[model samples]
Target: MTTTLPRVIGPWMAAAVVVGTVIGSGVFKKAQKVAEFCPESGVALSVWVFCGLLALLGGLTIAEVASRLPKAGGNYAFLRDAYGHWAGFLWGWVDFGIIRTSSIAVLAVMFIESLNNVLLLARLQYPADMEWIGTGLGRWEQVLATLSVIAALTFVNIRGTLIGGGLQMVLTALKVLSLLAILSLPVLILAFSPTSEPQPSASNFAPVWPSDWSQVNWAKFASAYGSAIVAVMWAYHGWLNITPIAEEVKQPQRNIPLALIGGIALLIFLYVGANVAYYTTISRNEMLDLKGTPVSTEFCRRLLGSVGVLVGSLILMTSVLGSLNGNILVAPRLLYAMGDDGLAPAKLRQLHPRFQTPSAAMMVFSGWAMLLVVAVAVAKETSWIDEKKNVFDVLTDYCIVGVAMFETMGVAAIFVLRTRQRELTPLLPYRCPGYPIVPAVYVLILVAVVANMFIGTEQRTEAKVGVGYALVGGLVYALFLRRKEA
Candidate 1:
């Protein structure tokens, strides 16, 4: 089997990948979840802003490292350079086995679920007695759709990162533009039609605590803010993925850093803007009391009418699809990297003769993703857990944990790199503005999030399980895999 490396992605396309992956289904869907914790509109907006800052800080640090190293494995490359082969291998293990795959699975499910909602609503409006339209598809149908989505994206990715990267840019732009249009229209309408009273509810624009600071729940404040950071950080997860394609980037030492910081700043603005728009059009109380279903989608329905609902649903579907595409784009590169180093089966290192892509590794990843979809579908059908807790819920839990693990380790790597690698090239092009301070602050915030994760064991049991799985996987790889390599 011959090895075929992908062409370098340029700065603009690299930025697109970061934006595309970071701004996916989570932004549209997770607003309701944020609302659950921070009911006050101002608080929610603040949370979004703060999360953006954290993302910015993390991105800056990653940009510095990526600029310096400019490798394909991203975190894996960072860890290997900073620490040792074992640390890098652990990052790869989790990324390939859990983080990327689970994320793709969850997004794929959301894509199907969002589409289902749109179809059901269309049926309800036009054909009053369309039973099949509203009815949930059987397990097999879901598995098929999930596989179909993965397979289609997998084929695109196998063509090479150039095509994949280009498609991601277009889809990302469309998704962002659609969201902004959706958000802006209602505000414009309300401004023009002053007589139209938007529904009243909790103070959407008021501060959660009075200016005096007397009413603050210092304890709950700490906890709520910490937990909110966890959610926000999760939403801001993909800033570091740019490093994986660093080798493909033109003038990576200069462009990778710029792309990382610029991409994250753009995402922050969009998230904050979108949330503010949501509050401006809909009241905080309505957002908070949005029961039985998610509020973000409902908010879209109320703002746009029937057409709005379909458009919002389509936007969300596209968002998830982009995220899935990103996961597929980056994850296989890890397998290829690992195989190159003889950490995994070398056959995975094989590149296609014609396509110049990792054909073997791509197939393996697609098959694994399909299997996960089947396992999840079967689990849901069989009531493996209470029907109340669906497979979607379980997988989301697993993904969060996996992501948290990577984040915690990745941030720690920032420190490790500073201390261990003295001989690396002089920092060039971009540097984290605050440097030691910014990275240090990010590490502290991450620690606080992990502490909060432990505190809310009941709510975040899945997160705990995810951590356990990561630790176990790391240990196993270190003992069996790493030792053999050594």
Candidate 2:
């Protein structure tokens, strides 16, 4: 039986989903990592901006594709139409098994951790020896909080798309406002505080360039940029989420491009502005010292005192929570799409009769996500994995590799669609702006990222596991799932 769904999301709603998804845990926590590799504030800022431009270009290309094919199963639909069902099935397989779920779980855990930090700070005046609820609720407490948030949001999604969309919109506004406040705080404090240092002179404003090309190993620099791109691209990754709800968007063709491009532009501005603010107040050395430490909160505390710490924590929590919500909102549709294709159990496609939401699909997703959270948390608690390497880093390494594989395959799909369907070309509403050149550049950058995955000492196992998972996913689709469907 065919179901008719409501067009509850418009351009703004779609944009909010994209922005909310992209601005998650990365920005709040990843700057120090970026700073670690790039060293110079100017270089770090420039790298961020460059990543934004890359994201913009990728957005432009995908927008053109999305406008042409406004379907539920984003890259899956694109691959299916361009290549065949086998390719589409593989795409969906990787998406469901690895990329999307891992991302959501990682972000959710981060949000919980951020909130826990805020709560701990609030209770700081309590006697140091006193315990609120045995061991005083640290990381494990954060996990429980995260799971609670996930459960609540899952209920919202299962209840109805309208409620889910509304929550997204509200949270998106809060997140943006929080970011603006973050950017403005240092300037405001400098203006009002008697102890604030004077603004630097013009010479100080000049961008720092790396000198001594001999000291800078070109090979090492290339490898580092490649590695950095994985993190950078992850930060910029979710612009494509808009396409999943394309059918639910009013004027899908026109609005899809606007949402994708607009969201990327907004993120670009905020990222650059925030990084500039970060550099202005804190020395490069300070940012570097805080690498992989809980020092971000401490940095804010030093700059704005206790008030700043609270504010920063609130902003980070909201940012990650909004991001988790965005993921929850979009991920179930992948399962629903698979069910519709007869690749997955038909039960997953069932929509709530009254709410008109994918209740079954969302439930399955939430269950799987909860399992992942518990598994990772248990591993940490048992000391099976080092607490120093968080679940976020581990998942990111896997996701980066998975996403790189999909992106590589996706870029290839463009050429395949062009060559295989020459006669159907006139029907496409949008086309890539720079034709071969633009897509070619995207492929080059993606290749660089994949190569860089092997270069880094950190997160190497995660990267290997990611690649292994993708390969196994492809094999599963080929030998079992694809054959059954065929």
Candidate 3:
């Protein structure tokens, strides 16, 4: 039986996973929320830059731990080695159960949403009219589309990481190039013809600070900024995605660190640039007026007219697909590692003889994600909440709190690992640049986000649900995994 995955992924592919997994639906969709929270162009831009740096700090700190371990489970290994079996198991448990699956579900749902945008822009609809299927939710078509995407990507990843990783590289390039084209659209339009109607202007950035600063309530500003940080966190959510497949990465000590840091740095630039493009082409009031519509769609409409919306929606779909593929490529490695340790089903450790991939784990993860997609859609149709939040919003709100708690602890493991001096023999290949300060700040910020979730009214119930879901993993550990470890 094949017991190991091959180290066929190179530095570029590794970097692509990091960049590709993160640059998903957030930058394209969440800018409107950021603008809503901040309501001032300057403050909104600052939030983007600030959150990007937060991801950078996280990447920097985790890179050191990854370099030392360079194992299959990434942060799973970090937590296990630094803390204990319980800590590691909880990470993997919550990961497979909620965080990772919710991420995939959200991406797949977003992909379908983007497709819907394209159809709406072109004035088309699903031909079959399956509205009778699920209480006429009118979303049966979308749920089916989301399921189809999840199934397709799951099969692609199960073939092998080489195929998956290569696909990721290509998709990453396409998305990055597309974003660059977007940022340059205004310049291109003006250069070709100076008399364009909605030309990009520097004046759009006026009132650099909130105009009514003295009149502003300091408490309200702090609350709004905190909420903005939470919104941007979803955009920068997948920084550690590459680490899970560290064993599959060639020269992991060198490549993993480079991928983590460099990928985040590039993302920082692209995300900030994208926001600049959005704000420069339109006023802050225009962005606010979107009223839940994606700001990018309108930005494209202004620049490319009707054709621009189609192109932009298609680009966003591809971006979501790249992220979905990247997540599928790496996430199952955690399950595979868990199986090897007997923390999960032994079959999960089994690799496909011909392809040498974790087929069982990949299928299980994808299946659960598809179920979530359908369940969320059904719940909305049945009025699970009075407001009727979409699948994307519900999943994101339900998953972020658990993610924040564990990831914060994962970063803090650097301190513990450093103190224990377990793997410092050869002098680490990469140490986090700012050391204690960097990791400390990263941990502190996430802790603040978590606290705000509990204290604030908007997401309190979702936060409670997320925590309860994670604790359910703890219960499983006590009943099943603890005996196996002993």
TM-score each candidate: 0.91, 0.92, 0.94
Candidate 3 per-residue lDDT over residues 302-390, each given as its tens digit: 88777777888899999999999999888888888888888878999899988999999899888988888888878777888556444
Can you write out model 1's per-residue Cα lDDT over 75-157, one digit (the tens) per residue?
87777777777777877777776677777777787788777777877777678666667576655776688889889999998
C-alpha-based local distance difference test score of model 3: 0.84
Prediction 2 TM-score vs. true: 0.92
Higher-lDDT candidate of 2 and 3 = 3
Q: What's the lDDT for all of these models? A: 0.73, 0.75, 0.84
- How good is model 1 by TM-score? 0.91
- Candidate 1 pairs with clashing backbones: 8-248, 9-248, 202-285
Ranking by TM-score: 3, 2, 1
Displacement of residue 405 (Cα, Å) in model 2 is: 1.3
In terms of TM-score, how similar is model 3 to the real structure? Answer: 0.94
lDDT of 2: 0.75
